[model samples]
Target: MVLPLSKDVSGKGVNVDQGSLNIKEVIDLLNGDAWVRLVASGAEGTWSLRHLHAVIGSQPPAWPDHDWIYGDIALLRAKLSIDRLKDALVAEDCRRFSVGSIEVEVPEVGPQVGWRRRPSFEQHDRERLQKPTWDLRVSAAQTSQHQLNRSGYLVGRSCPSFPDLQYAFRAFFEGDFSLNGGMSLPSELMVIRVINDEGWIGPIHVTPTHIDVQVDGRDLLGASLELYSTDQRTTTDLNSPNTVTFELPGGLPDTNVWLWLKKDGRWLDYRALYRPWATPDQLEAAGVKIDLPVDPLSTIEALVSGGEGPQVEFKRSLPETKSKDRNPYKTIAAFATMEGGWIVFGVDRDELTVVGLEVDDINGERDRLANLIRARVNPTPPFEATPYVIDGKQIMVLRVDSGVSPPYGIAVDPDAKDRPEYFVRRGASTYPAWPADLREAVMSRQPPAGFPNGMGGLGGAFPG
Candidate 1:
């Protein structure tokens, strides 16, 4: 339960009435630089609360048993003291108190500049107090998932087999009653925790219509699956053994589903699920271009005018497969090794012109290209072959996906002792994969860091 201090920060008044105290009043008090004291008289004792200070990332000597001290110092101290206040209130011992009286040690100093403080906003009057240990669990759960590309085709998360996502919690303040500026404020504090009751859920599959997930080897008689996104949540009861399928009301593309859980009546962490999902901002920060034009004409014009880059390649005609120079197999292998991109045929490489293909059968050529890729590229990456008419010219675009199986290489010889050559794309040209590039591509294909072989497979059936 949170007891709001007085409106005056000069240690002059106390608000104890449970009917009138507002959250904005409390935020205004904490957002100041004045030193506030909680002077209380209860059945067991009469005392004032003392505050502690700790640096953002340093372990302060005051909290000796704690491994580390961090987070908002004022809020941390307030949270700790609030736990005590709550205990007294629950025991019916905190009878009367002044929670917002200003201390004499800290003079009338205004709010400090270039410092962190919770902004004054509308909030619940009663706030939940959390323990220092709570931070570790949340951080661990969030960082466990592997980073993958944000494919427009997939709207669900991929996790290491039986991901150890811990039980999650949410804390907030809810106003119950009100109080005057000088008296004690009385409220009930609630701590809510959501347990992942089934523990393991997946080998999940999500399509445009429904989500199907296998429960963690547990009886699903009373279980349910939930899809949460964009401040909206929908839950569906299990209809079959060891699995639950949820029909999305708004469809998959409109809702980026965050949680795919098998639970009885518990909630999951939205933030933890969000860590594996890449936002456009996150992609840009990682140097992945996300703002490329979607229109084929505009995109092709830009590609032709700007020449080629890491993700865009142009060829005057079909790849010269007989020679190693400017081989399409190498380009395909490079796209698989890096973030996937396009290979455009019927475009002049040097002159930057859209010279259409002279082929009689575009469909046959696409099939031949597919066959060539299958025969030449080992452990082939997924791609889409489509013929487009740009400038009244026939052009082929092979849209490749970032390979799930990486360090893709081209077959050098079906009978010789030569290694299949790996390739990568850098700065507008296909190049031999450097040792580090090969290593990173290999690592990226592996299960996210920390999962061992005993864990379930890392693959999940996504839309892509």
Candidate 2:
């Protein structure tokens, strides 16, 4: 029932002001294959209840006997009305493209019945698996929803224009919520080409787990895709640390075929660009600007409040020397050997309370811990020990990156059985590194593909 102001001089897309317009105009435009962009605009001034009446008045008899105004053309609530038109037009066999939120009736009237309220689209098209829809989705997955405006975690090419092409879009929870942070990693990125709008509609933050491509009513499966960025881009491929090179078919940068780039690698501090779909104006090309994540404090707060998982753990104090099981070294060694993670200390594990400390004398404590780590472990892992105060309570946050050289263990006695050898953090606890884990740690040390310094290749011979 909504139509944005057309991009042309006469606003030929829809004639809202018409007192008695011919239906042929609608049919003729559809025949020419104009995109169905239902954005609400000033055309509302001229549009009365009649426009919706026209769409519903023509509903065929075989169509469900639902009232027009009460059913498909009910209160135009937010972005949902656009898709209501989509469903109706699709019934008439017209192809439609939709963006932003979709409107769906809960407990769809059929054998299978359930309700998934809010922004999730799954409830609407599970069995039908709506085809040929391209998703460039970005969701703000963590605990509290955040504005992508000037976010610290994401990088973009140009300053985002505004709400349309801007990053301050909202994302919601999918079932796979993180217990520690309660935020899910964003998985899908949906980019829409709109009409008369300054930029693309959306591709907000989402949980990192949902990754896929659906274009032209088709699902893209098992296709080889690659990410391209400048050397200055600070990109982290969350899926893995291994370098990935994409091999494309002959005609990219020139085809209408849709491309998808999920939030697998994060970039910041510069313009981020992805050329996935052809613009509605096919002759012209443009780079889509993406939104970034929230600031560090919010991220930390979410993680600390979340349940312990493979990536997070809490410690009452520093690692104990005599008590092999008492030290945090095992966990440190484990994180380095596996996917890098975060460790928070000075919190009472039993109550998860932050008890302030005077681990004062910063340099002294820093030196002591540094020396202790060097003396106690072999091939020390890459880490940074940051002791800071949160809520006026002294605590330390230890960050461990998966090591360049791993398999680090207790130095003195490498074969000790009581304390166990290399350790790894599983769901919520650290355990002796499994044999498979050990093998992977060794392989992680190998230089990625062409890098020669760690490979004992040519770079090693040219000493400083």
Candidate 3:
């Protein structure tokens, strides 16, 4: 039994130096007016003498007696004794909340009966789901057991602080088991909340044949949800009120994408639904082979063998062709604005031969191309201009990856700061992207997760 030291001892306090008191002596002192303080501080809260004695001494009749017999109480250190007291109190509270009382009636005494453990309060009540009481009870029992199996005699004084107990309690109430110092809680006990705008969004699952996204919200029922990238869009109306399954269309360019909700004839703000779980590892685990970047020589060979197509363009020289339609900058913009392609300088498209450049300084030529791209292409895309030696011929191969931020454009006038013109590649030729294509391009790169929608309209303007 444990009790707080009353400041008003009235000279009745026992000399603690005369230690090793028995259980009866401790109970007598606590039941009387003068009690020994088990806790060092009063801020730990007060416990009544009767509550302490009953928890340590009382048991139901025919209760198949356990290790915690009366003699075991005599050997308990102050900290373990206090922990037991706390556990009993929390368990009592749980029992009361679950079944309206801590008292449980059992069968009459008989021989050869199975030893029954006390019923956990959850067995009594399941629907109400009083999580706070359940969490506190479990944490208290765990703390008591942890203190009992220690290494040293410091068990008498060692106890977790009030704040530590509170943190454990909160950890149990939430879904975070990591905060509980290696204690594993059951998965069903975890309560997690996913924060999102319209509703909860599950992980974006990507496989070779399909990409699936699961979204759920009561407000989204019968509403249209749109998932789009540079050149593709997939829309679906919610049929299930709880979770709507979205099977995104195949052939999406490798870009970070967004999900949009159409409401009141206008598209609401878009947000990225990709989490850390949406990784290349996940795709590979599902039997999707992640293609690495091909070697430049290998790509050049493939382009030469295949000739000019939608994703490959050949240029004979550096300063751009005399015809505006054949300009190298237009090809760069087209590759960036559409699915990306390569611009091979020093390659004659008509003859399908690598004629090679005559420049002495290859690095300087690369820098010139880089500077021209910066001046000509608005919102510069990721590209590489490298000098490759193929069969003793030097050629400049500029490879542009598919743009994450799309609608990349070429300047209408390099000397002026006016809006640039957008273009796309089709079958071996580059041309101005139509109004619809430009809209899709602009929609491909939405404002990132939390920023407000800054693009005023979807007509022809890009997000500033």
lDDT of every predicted structure (CA atoms):
0.44, 0.37, 0.44
- lDDT by residue for model 1 over 1-464, one digit each (tens)? 11123343323334211222222232232211211122111122223222112122222223221111111011112222333322322234442223323211111111221111111110111121110101100111112121111111111132111111110000101211222212112111111111122233434455556656544423446556666778467776664456666575655534344544333333211111223466654433322232222457776787688778877788778764455553887889887777667788999988899999998999889998887788778787788788888988999987776677777888667333246888887789888888998887666543334432211121111112
Best model per TM-score:
1
Q: After superposition, which runs of candidate 1 have C-alpha atoms over 4 Å from their true positions?
A: 1-294, 320-326, 414-418, 433-437, 440-464
**Local lDDT at 145 for model 2:** 24
Worst 10 residues of 1 by lDDT: 163-172
TM-score of 2: 0.34
Q: Comparing candidate 2 with candidate 3, which one achieves the higher lDDT? A: 3
Better of 1 and 2 by TM-score: 1
Q: Count the backbone clashes (under 3 Å) in each candidate.
A: 20, 37, 1
Please provide, for model 3 over 1-464, each residue's C-alpha lDDT reduced to its tens digit, 9 standing for 90 to 100. 11222322223343211112222223233221111111011112211111111112222111211111121111111212333332323343432111111122111111111111111112232211111110111112222222322121111223222223223222322223254353322222111111112333333454433556555443555566677766557887764433334443554346666666544443322334333455654433322233333356665776787788766788887864233442787888877776566778889999999999888988888898888777778788877788888888888877765566777887776765477888977788888989997887566644334332321121111111
Name the runs in model 2 displaced over 4 angstroms.
1-296, 320-326, 412-420, 434-437, 440-464
State residue 441's C-alpha deviation in candidate 3, in Å. 3.7
All-Cα superposition RMSD per candidate:
17.9, 21.5, 24.7
